[model samples]
Target: MAEIKVEKKKPIWPWIIAGLIVLVILYFLFANGDDDEMIDETEQEQVIDTTSIEEENTANWDNNRNDTVGGVDGYLSYIGDESRMGIDHEYTNNAIIYLMNAVQAKANELNVNIDADIEEIRQKAEKITQDPMATNHADKIKDAGSDLTNVIENLQEEQFPDLSQDVQEVKSAVQDIDGSVLTLEQKDKVNKFFDEAGDVLNKMS
Candidate 1:
């Protein structure tokens, strides 16, 4: 028998060790992948939470319009467009109507009676602007704004006689004026009225 030079079987241990190394590398890769996915999910949740907080803050700001005189001032100020030409007859007329409406609403809230009729004032303002002979429609609107200021002042004095009533009524009236429009002068008057009224209300509280 030829001396069986049985080739020593290639060490099986080396092949087994290589296989084990490959499995270890694969395990580390899979673990790292899972960790990356978890990190991504956590970051996404944080972003969502931040967005929700921002939305809530915005909502709170809007809701403030219904609580205080300053809020009404903010609402009205936002609506008035200074860029709109006061010389435009139609625009002036519409501005007067809006002013009258805002005044009337505030008066009603305070349980004060305004002698002027809002609808009548609106109609008259419109007619004055439309008349070809009218040369001073803008001045007329300014006069209306003045009249509104007078009414607000009168209310601030007389309507707020009772602290409970004044506080309650003012609270009820504190709401968003979504579509209010005014001229620059009218806006100033409105802001002044609110300032005075707020002082009175604060005293009562």
Candidate 2:
């Protein structure tokens, strides 16, 4: 009898399973990469939208004009109905700018430099200049208000007392300045500052 040898076949299941696992891993890697790309694109779009909004605001500010100014109010004092005093309120918090503008305009008309007085007022109103809508600095607000009254009085008395008889009215108006919005009384007081001041401005014009 001749010796016979039988050869056994190797199992292919393990190799097939390994190949399927490799395919799954490749698929997941590509899918995650695609997801990251999409996220990046979305972020870029958001940034573009934000940039456009800021640009539109800048354009509006440059093109906007106010024409309803009456009496002593400067036509350029406010863009639209609000008294912006040519200030970009979005970037600035100068609460007393309106008052400052009133005085500056008068000083300019008289060919005088009241920079010292203005700086003194600014120093007294550090809280207001830093944040217009602040309400916490009671003493600071009071002191600044007092300084405003005194400044207006001195400016009027030294320059032309006949121009305005109600220079003291600013004290009441300044007391109500807890925020940017003004009450009727506040507006009237401010108008007093600008009323006769406007006459001087008109003469210069």
Candidate 3:
């Protein structure tokens, strides 16, 4: 009998085919994943853009309206109801002037007596600037400072005299309110001033 002849089949070709198929599948999966990541990034960017647009729209809307302002009393001296010299209302202007004068007098007395008390008054006044009802009065209070400063300057120039005793008394009353200290007598005075100031403010509108 002739020796049996045998041949070994090559396995390399099958392995190469399987590797190529696996690489192709990996490539497709990686490419699809990259596309999904890009889509997510774009969505996030669009959301940020939409939020910015809404904020800008809200700001524009706010800018168009004449909103009621508070804490403008300091600058009230610079503008008037009719845009004339100082405030236009006679009663309101005079009452504010009176209040300012009183504050100045009290401030002077307290300055020599207890500077700490004056500081306390200032702190209280600053706090009042935050109140909803008091914000509108801030301008008036600030303007009062200007008015009193002007008077003091005039006195320094010898064009004005020192505040009178009545003015001093009035100032003491206001200082009590400004310092959040109220005696029975001071309380009565403060109530009167409040009533008068309310009338003046009501007339402004």
Among all candidates shown, the one with the greatest TM-score: 2
Q: Rank the candidates by TM-score, best first.
A: 2, 1, 3
Give a tens-digit lDDT track for model 1, residues 116-183: 54444444455544553455543554444444445554665665555544444333332211113333
For candidate 1, the lDDT comes to 0.49
What is candidate 3's lDDT per residue for 77-192, written digit by digit as tens? 32233222122223333334333333334334334232343334344333322333332343444334333433433333332234333334334434444323312223344344
What's each prediction's TM-score?
Answer: 0.37, 0.45, 0.29
Error of 3 at 134 (Å): 40
Over 1-205, each residue of candidate 2 has an lDDT whose tens digit, in order, gives 9989988899999999999999999999999999999999999999999999878754532322211113225422431233533222231223344445555556666677767776776665544333444434444544555675666666676776664545444555455444434222244443443333333434333
The 10 consecutive residues of candidate 1 with the worst lDDT sum are: 170-179
Q: Give the residue spans of candidate 3 off by over 4 A.
A: 1-5, 62-205
lDDT of 3: 0.41
**Which one wins by lDDT: 1 or 3?**
1
In the predicted model 3, the residue pairs found to clash are 71-135, 72-139, 73-138, 73-139, 73-140, 74-139, 74-142, 74-143
Question: Of the pair 1 and 2, which is ahead by TM-score?
Answer: 2
Ranking by lDDT: 2, 1, 3
TM-score of 3: 0.29
